[model samples]
Target: MNPAREAMINGWKSPRKGDRGRERERDITAPRHDSSSRISKPARQQPPAKSTASNAVGKYLTQDQQSEQFVADEDKFVLKQAKKKADIRVREQRAKPIDYLAFSLRFIDTDRDVFDDHEGDVEVDIPAPETVLESLNHAQLQELHEDLTSYQTLESNARNKEFWSALLVLCADRRQKLKPQGPEGRALASVASDVDNILSPKSLEQLEALEKQIRTKLQSNEPIDTDYWEELLKSLLMYKAKAKLRKVCEAIKAAKVELLRLVDPEKAEELEESDGLPANSHNFAPSPAKPATRPVASSSDAQSSAAPPPGTARFSSTGNEDFSQATKALYDREVARGVGEGEEIFAAEEAVPSATKPLWADKYRPRKPRYFNRVQMGYEWNKYNQTHYDHDNPPPKVVQGYRFNIFYPDLIDKTKAPTFKIIREHGRRRGESFAPAGKEDTCLIRFVAGPPYEDIAFRIVDREWDYSAKKERGFKSSFDKGILQLHFQFKKIYYRK
Candidate 1:
């Protein structure tokens, strides 16, 4: 312990003169170990020093330069916003165009009177269900059945229910006709005759109850005829569809009446009074007042008549009155086609009278049919025109073709097709012209159909028609799906060089 204490005290004391001199000499003479000689280590790069001159210049910048910089930033921002807004507007306003050809039946008003002269007219005799059914072959009957089923599924209106009942009656009549002497066939016919009663005057609750009862009978294995009861069940479904449709239509009508009353009380009252008329009446005018008491038919007479009740509304037996979503889509597509390039509306009007009164005018309402037509236009490009005008500066366009579309969805007889005829004015025959210089001869094209639709006509340029069946000639004349179309182009005339 004494030795260690003495050594520590000696180390703390100042170094001897000889030891200090030797150490200083060794530090001075030893090989210098600069930073490069030491072990290398990574170091972060120092940032460049900011120039005080630039900062001083910024502080002294003029007001106009700052304003210009701000304006440039604002312009960039505004342009970006405007582009965003334009893109949104384009998306919102985009819509498909309409094509006149290939139009939908839904847009056509089957009962619309072009002349508005059918007021107070007696209703035409509705086709007998048996007569219509008897004419249909098995395939046609099946097709009709399928169409009705699809229509009923789409909308359950009173008119649809009536058609459905007529179909069932037709089926029952066929079964009875096949085995008239059989008791089962007679029983089936009698049961099927009650289909109308099952459909009409029954609420949805009542129909549902009847359905439950029929199911219960079947489920319990009751001694009831399975086929007859099953048929009743089918009638019940039809009734349900009808009831639902009527309920919806009534609600819509009531709402419309209320709205009309709020807007115009007199029109609402008139509409209400018109609604009270016999549903079969085609006229919108108020009916003649009736006496308080009327003769009641005998039960036997009433039972024998197959006519519908006075309150029953009449509708087209062939197709639906309202447009479905699919039909609307089809209508939109057809309308989008629009007029072809270099074409325009030429003539659109009903046909002029030819001194012959229609036979069905006295029996049914007489109203003009409706039509849409177009005429193709193009430069004649004759020798004189070619010499005077270029492609950029063309001559006046001349009529080159005609397109006619006549709608007749409500023809009284479905068996008959519409017809058209050309009428020359001023007692002039075909190829005869009395027009002044520079004026072209024109003729009326009259379209004829069965009542309640009347004849419609249009004036057209008189020219030689190209009846070639080639598609390029664009000659089409046919009546299909309730539309009578007559499209044809005129033969071009070329001048000799």
Candidate 2:
């Protein structure tokens, strides 16, 4: 270290600058020949072999298997996400509506306890008549009808009666408008409304007496508007049907209450004591000794206590052969067939009076069968409409077709099917239009079925039906499985340039 520092001092004092510069250049240009001075580089690692096994397996999978695999994978992912969210919610102490309901129900002693406090009180707030009538659109009115019918079956009380009557009055007013009648018809309608209100509270026997009187009037050769009398008879029958249904529902409710009472320990003990069983009977009772016979007695008691099947009891309560399985089936079918989305009800009538009674009227009472019909509406892109409207701004929808579904489950003659006839007013023939400008001609399409089911009719636009067998045209007229379905579309008129 001392010699190197002396040499570096001598070099710094030397005046030969050219020789020192040439030596530094030579040192930088020279290569390192020593083994230790050479640095080693790491070997290039080959990339891991690309996996073709997954691709090969995927290539062999069928369409259905692939779909199933995709669904399973999606389900797994959804389950994972749901579980994670549930854990987070649990940690946050968030409760769902059902959880709250379950917690509240834990304190309740019995089912009856939930409603005992609010007995004889209306649970829901009913809107005013005007408000309801104005607010309810076509679909809402249909829903209201369904709800009221259900309420009538479950709870046929004074409150429900008031609601039903109000609906009836509304319906009557609508009917009068649809079927414009003379002065005599108007007078009869007012009388009918008053009679309906009076008959609302009448017992089954009283209603039966009134029905007989009306029928007698119809059967007699008296000067009377037959249509009004027949309508009255039909209404009477409907009231009778409702009364019978109510009685059955009340009986069922009572049975359920009795069963609940028996289930209660205290009530059971009270009942046993009331039935002349001694308090200390258990100590001396021979019932335990003959356990084999107890099952037989219990079985018999169960059979006796069981309520009759509804289908069998349906028409039996009326004590008449008039209301058959067909009637009940039709009623149920109509109830189940609610208004379709985007479809409008053009005209719906429960019963249309028949001019003449069938020959088998005595054997089976002639009554108008129930029907639920619909009118399909859609934009008709004719020359006028196409010129004025586009997809973004559509034209007004007109009645494109009619769908008539009538039920007659228990037709007397199964071999013979129902038929329909078009009845024109003012002696107007087919293709003849006596209607005012901008109005279309209309006619009654009366559907005639076998005995016990009277003729029902509906007014429809007088136009040629599209009888094409194509699905788009939707022309169908057939009676199958107790339903008479007549679906047809109007023939579209095209204007050529």
Quote each prediction's TM-score. Answer: 0.35, 0.37
Tens-digit lDDT string for candidate 1 (1-497)? 33334336755334365666554445443444455466768998998977998877767766888897787676545433332222221221211100000011111213222332122111221122334345444544554456445333433235434434545545444444544367765666686667886567789888888888889999995688788778778667766755654453344345445555766777666655653212322211111121110001111111111333353322111111112233233333333444567766444453366547778768965654444467888889888889999999999898899988766666778799998889888899988889999899988888878877766677788989998888867689888776677899998887775
Best by TM-score: 2
Q: Which stretches of candidate 2 lie over 4 Å from their true place?
A: 1-341, 350-354
lDDT of 1 at 248: 39
- Overall lDDT per candidate, in order of appearance: 0.52, 0.54
Tens digit per residue, CA lDDT, model 2, 152-233: 3333245434435545445434444445589876877678777688778889899999998988898999999898778777
Least lDDT summed over 10 consecutive residues: which range in candidate 2? 277-286
